[model samples]
Target: MDVLIVGAGPTGLTLGIDLARRGVDALVVERAEALFPGSRGKGIQPRTQEVFEDLGVLDAIRAAGGPYPVRAIWKDGERIGEQPMFEPVEADESAPYTEPLMVPQWRTQEVLYARLVELGGRVAFGHELTGLEQDAEGVSARFADGSAVRARYAVAADGGRSAVRRALGVAMTGETVDPSPFLVADLRMTGLDREYWHTFPRPDGTGLALCPLAGTDDFQLAGKFPEGTEFDLSLDGVRRLVAAYTHLDAEDVTELRWASDFRPRAALADRFRVGRVFLAGDAAHVHSPAGGQGLNTSVQDAYNLGWKLGAVLKDGAPEPLLDTYEEERRPNAAAMLGLSTGVHRGEVQRGKATVQLGLGYPESALSEDRRAAPAGVRAGDRAPDGRVDGVRLFDAFRGPHWTLLGAPAAAAGVHALPAAPKSYGPGVFLVRPDGYVGWAGDSAEGLGAYLARAGVR
Candidate 1:
């Protein structure tokens, strides 16, 4: 294959789909025989949805995952203010796929897998990347089954304990500060009065939460057990924690499913990529599951890099374009890690309307205009989806395209911008394919100069 991707988790699968859509040949190798199950990543952010829309599977995703908003409440023996839930996207903006969806990590993978299949690509389940060796031309990989695979480029989407990262001798350094234990499970509750999730502080570390699946009435609960006590999400642990925390008696409830005693960790990789081998998703980052951003962030990373990789392989994009993957994604991952950590430590409460939606791309090729805002148009920023004057830019997270939105030089590309050049000054603007402004004139009067500056010859 042209590209070899390790680990068919959410990130890897999504990248595989993207590569196929771009007409790039890709093969994904996953260790597991099947995709993940249950509700691991329960929340999805607006940025993630934008990536989905760009993939052209947003409709399927919305059909599979949810149009539901996941909420967080204080467990200090009382409820508090909640984010004022609004429509997925406001009418004034360019971002079409706005709002978070509450779906399990496994289901997200399933949707991505379907997209890949539709695009004529398939994942190699049960085939694992045991080791890897790379040189100038390409990367050679050895699998657990005594098999080898080679490709022009290989992405270590294999996840946090990436075998590929280890083969490259890349070291990760960080503190496992809060190694708290929590019992988690997906069970079919016989019946419940209400349909919302709950988290309360009990005598143990943290009381717990019952996040129900998006469509099904069945519920999944996770709670911190006592330090000295054995932890398990088995039927016994569920009954024990539920009985201890809530007044409802769950003994009559059948124990449908159970997850072994597991402790999710929070940490970050020191570096993301090394040489010809690139790291994406959990292979490049690890963090707490607060806000359920882990899966979402990882999937988005794949979305950002897959197109760039395809562009490099097929369109002869510049080398610097690939470097932007780490430059643009690291900070976003760091931000997500920070927010998730606060939630894990119970340091702060999260609202659905938190500015997580406004997360932007901080890296861009555009030169800085002293008078212009540093992040006026960035690499990782939300690619606004809407209309520019009478022209529609992005229906979703549309990115810069050479095929469209090209102006002579001084015409500025601004979404829903109606101001005329006379009133807006002489500056010219061009919108990127992703619904971001690429070139900007000094002022409305600088239109010709701006076009000249941006090489709009």
Candidate 2:
């Protein structure tokens, strides 16, 4: 196989879809018997929505979720004024998705998994990775069920307590973002309006919040408890907690679907890659669920690595292109880690920074800028979506091939589309498969050489 992705969460399944669409041979393996049943990471950022658009699942995702509702602050069982959960930003052509969408993490994974399968990708469930060994050529992964598979490269999307990362002897260095433990659960309950996210504070300084999960008859319950507090994960416990915190009876919570508890943390792997095996998702960096950056960052990690893997395995690109994955993603993940921690500590608000539209690889070695007079859009910036001449920029860039925008009509060996919008200025821009500008120049003088150096002919 070309790539073996361990863990069938959003990261692995997304990578699977990208690889399948690129016609790369890849397989996703999950240790659990099925998809995760919890709604751990619920917020899908705007940038991730763009990724869904490129992956051909945007309509399904949009149909499966809704915008986050205004948060209704509660005190002593009284309804207070409603405040927006996230800062509002009007959708523009450059950034079509200006707000975060609320969907259960399980639904997101299901959507991604279905897309992967539809693209002719295979997923091996109940296959747990026990050990992994890599040579100069390929990787050999041994599963706990006495099964083994060999692949050109492997990714560890197995999550924060990653067994693959542990086997590779990679260390994760981070501090605890919050010492207070928190509980999250998906429950079926009444006595609450779905129009608002309800919050109930405790006298001890910890609090409980419940948000009606979009496209489902369920509310996700989240609560922070004092240190050393022993929380229950049973239906009775859930009902009791709800009754104690809010103006509802214990019977208000009718059902308990899933429950989990954890202390908030922010950690990044010592390295994203170890030889032929790479770490993505929680395996690469574990973030607090405060700013809703953890899962989105993980999906972007898969997006960043998928194209490079496809380029190397299917496009005859040099192997060194794989090195840029860690080079470009680690620092970004580190910055996101800080952002998540800041949100958890109340130092940052959920605003444009959390939207992640501005995230790019300006300092990446793969980015080439040869413009004598640079303008608004430069190399390493995200190629915004717009209409150019008679073609849509995103429509032109939907496929696996690279796109050359605003270049002369005579430029050879590149998909030279119509000139971009005024936002990008008048220059030749070579958009990478991952939708970032790889090379930008006033003309095609140094464009061909840059593409050749980056293994794009």
Candidate 3:
């Protein structure tokens, strides 16, 4: 196997599918044999949907589920302000893919699992990664089966304990601040007028939030608490909260589905890559699910790493490209952490990049001389989309693959692939499989210059 993936959850499955789609040999090993039907997260961000569309999973996702409706916040069972969960995305036909759509996390996982199987790569069930040993060329992973498999690299998409990360000796450092306990319950709401999100506040001031299930009036209730205050809500406890928070009564609580407690965790690994062993998704960083960014960030993390790993392992192995896995993503990780913990991404990232964001970095091998900006969009950054022949390429066509967004003639300097986007973002821009602008070219000269610097020449 080219890569051994730990944890057959969303992130691992996504990584496996991406690598397999590109003809890379990758295997995902899960501790369990069957797909987890209990859905923890149901809200798929629009940005996430954009990614799904790129992966060719959006239509199936939308068909299986529905859209994410605007949700309401609540405290002590009282309604408060609504959140900016989803925005109206202008349907841009010229783009590679479409905007966001919402679905259950299990649905998302199932789609990726099916796709991986379709691509001739399957997730090994009951193969929990218990240990790892690596050398200069490859790594051998020990599973609970008392057997081991060798691969050039390993992706630790496993949950927090992360056997792969520990084996590699990567240090993850951060404070577990505000240990605000919260529980998420996913289920269908019955016997109520199907309306927008219903929110309420906890009077005791422990914590508060109420949101509509993605695309429906079904509910996902969130409650925060300080220290210990019966954080885990039982079916009856959940029913009580629903009744107190809204006018709905206990009898209306049709189903008391899966529920679990989690602390608002915020942390970042000191390193994402250590030789052949790397980390992606929750394994590297765990933050509060408050902003609905955990799963989305994990998907993007794998998206960013998959192509680079494939490039290095296959052909056109640019040594410098591997270094970018940390340079570009570390800061991005920091920004995500700051957002969840209320640290903020400084003024620049907040004011400019927060909206029309692009990537920025100081030490990217992709950006040598010639003075373009950094790798990812930070503060004061405006996101750049693509266009071709005066036609704008929107979010409909983007998938988890390399995309060219200009006339093949105009997009010189970069890899002159046979197919390209007619009208996309900036002039001669190279979008990472994860949908961030990696290499930018203003004109033919800039394109040529950047390609030369990036060793694409």
Candidate 4:
């Protein structure tokens, strides 16, 4: 196999789809016997929506989810007022997706997994990784059932308690974002309207909220508790907690589907790559889940690494091209960790920062700007969506190949757009497979060298 992915969550499944579409042989393994049965990580930010579009799962995702509802604050069983869940941002031509969508994490995984299988990819359920070893050439992984698989590279997407990360002896440097424990669950309930998120805040600085999960008949119940409290995960415990906090009785909670308790925290892996092993998703970084950055950041990590791996393993790119994964993603992960912590502590609002449309890698070794006067969309920036010369920019960049705009001549494998979008200013742009401009110039003067280095010619 070209790659062994350790986990079948959104991160690993997404990587599997990217690699499979690129014709790279990759396998995803999950310890769980089935997909996770919960509504955790329920927010899908705008940037991730673009990724899903490129992976060809956006329509299914949109069909399976809905937009976030207004928060309805309640005091003493009476509705005080309504507030927006996030700062509203208008959608424009350059940036089409503006707001976050509410899709249960399990549903999101289902969409990604289906797309992976459509691309002829496979995931091995019940394959629990026990040991991992790496050499100069490849990585060897051993499962609990005495089975072994070797691949040219391995990715640790097994989540925050990653067994693969532990095997590689990579440390995570982080701290607790909140000392207080919290409970989150998906359950059917009554006495709450489906149009609004019901929130009940107490005077003691602790409260609970019940939000109707979009595209489902369940409500996601989240409650904050005092430190040192041992909350129960049972249905009865959830009923009692809800009855105590809300106006409804315990019986209002009709059925419990899934429940889990956790303390919000933020942590990042000390390193993303260890020889032939790389860390992606929750295995590499743990977030507080406040600004909905954890799963999105994890998915983007897979996106940033997928093409580079494809370039090296298939296109004969130099090995050093792999090093940019850490140099580009680690710092971005660190910034997201801080943003997540800030949102959890009410230090930052979930507006533009959480949208993540502005993220890019301007300082990476692969990014080249030959233009003397760079403006608007420059190298290392995300290529915006627009229509140029009667061709949609996103449509031109939808495949597992590079895109060159404002270039008349065509390279062998690169997609060339004769005209640049008005929003892109006057310059030639080479958009990477991951949709970031890798090189920019006044003309196509230095485009050949950049494409050669990226192994795109």
What are the runs in model 4 whose C-alpha is more than 4 Å off? none
Question: Residue-pair clashes per candidate, as listed?
Answer: 29, 0, 52, 0
**Which 10 consecutive residues of model 1 have the lowest summed lDDT?**
396-405
Report the lDDT tens digits of candidate 1 across residue range 1-457.
6799998888888888788877888899888888776666666677677667777777777776665543445444455534333334453454444556767666677788888898899888888777789888888999889989989888988877888888888776545635566666777765443345555555546667666677555566766665555764567667766766765566834765646345656666666767678888877778766556788788768876786787678766565667767776777787778777777776755554332556656455432232254333332334455454555544522432321232332333223243322322333344443333444444444444433443332
lDDT for 168 in candidate 3 is 80
- Assess the local accuracy of residue 44 in candidate 2 as a C-alpha lDDT between 0 and 100: 95
Residue-level lDDT of model 2, residues 1-457, one tens digit each, is 9999999999999999999998999999999999999999999999999888899998898888888989998998898768887777778888888899988999998898889989999999999889899999999999999999999999999999999999999999999988998999999998998999999877777989999999899999999988998888999988888888889899999999999999988899999999999999999999999989999999999999999999888877789989999999999999999999998888989988899999999999999889888998989999998888868888888867688887654333357776778889878888988899998888888776777677775
Q: TM-scores of the models, in the given order?
A: 0.82, 0.98, 0.80, 0.99
Residue 354 in candidate 4 has what lDDT? 97
Would you list the C-alpha lDDT of every candidate in the order shown?
Answer: 0.64, 0.90, 0.63, 0.92
- Return the number of clashes found in candidate 2: 0
Per-residue lDDT of model 4, residues 1-457, tens digit only: 9999999999999999999998999999999999999999999999999998999999999999999999999998899999998998889988889999999999999999999999999999999999999888899999989999999999999999999999989999999988889999999998889999999988876889999999999999988887788887898999999988989999999999999999998999999999999999999999998899999999999999999999998898888899999999999999999999999889999989899999999999988999889988988899999998777788889989888888864577688888788899889998999999999999899788887888775
True-vs-predicted CA distance for residue 9, candidate 1, Å: 1.5
Superior by lDDT: candidate 1 or candidate 2: 2
TM-score attained by model 4: 0.99
Off by over 4 Å in 3: 72-100, 207-210, 215-218, 231-234, 240-247, 343-363, 368-386, 390-435, 440-457
TM-score of decoy 2: 0.98
Model 2 worst lDDT run, 10 consecutive residues: 407-416
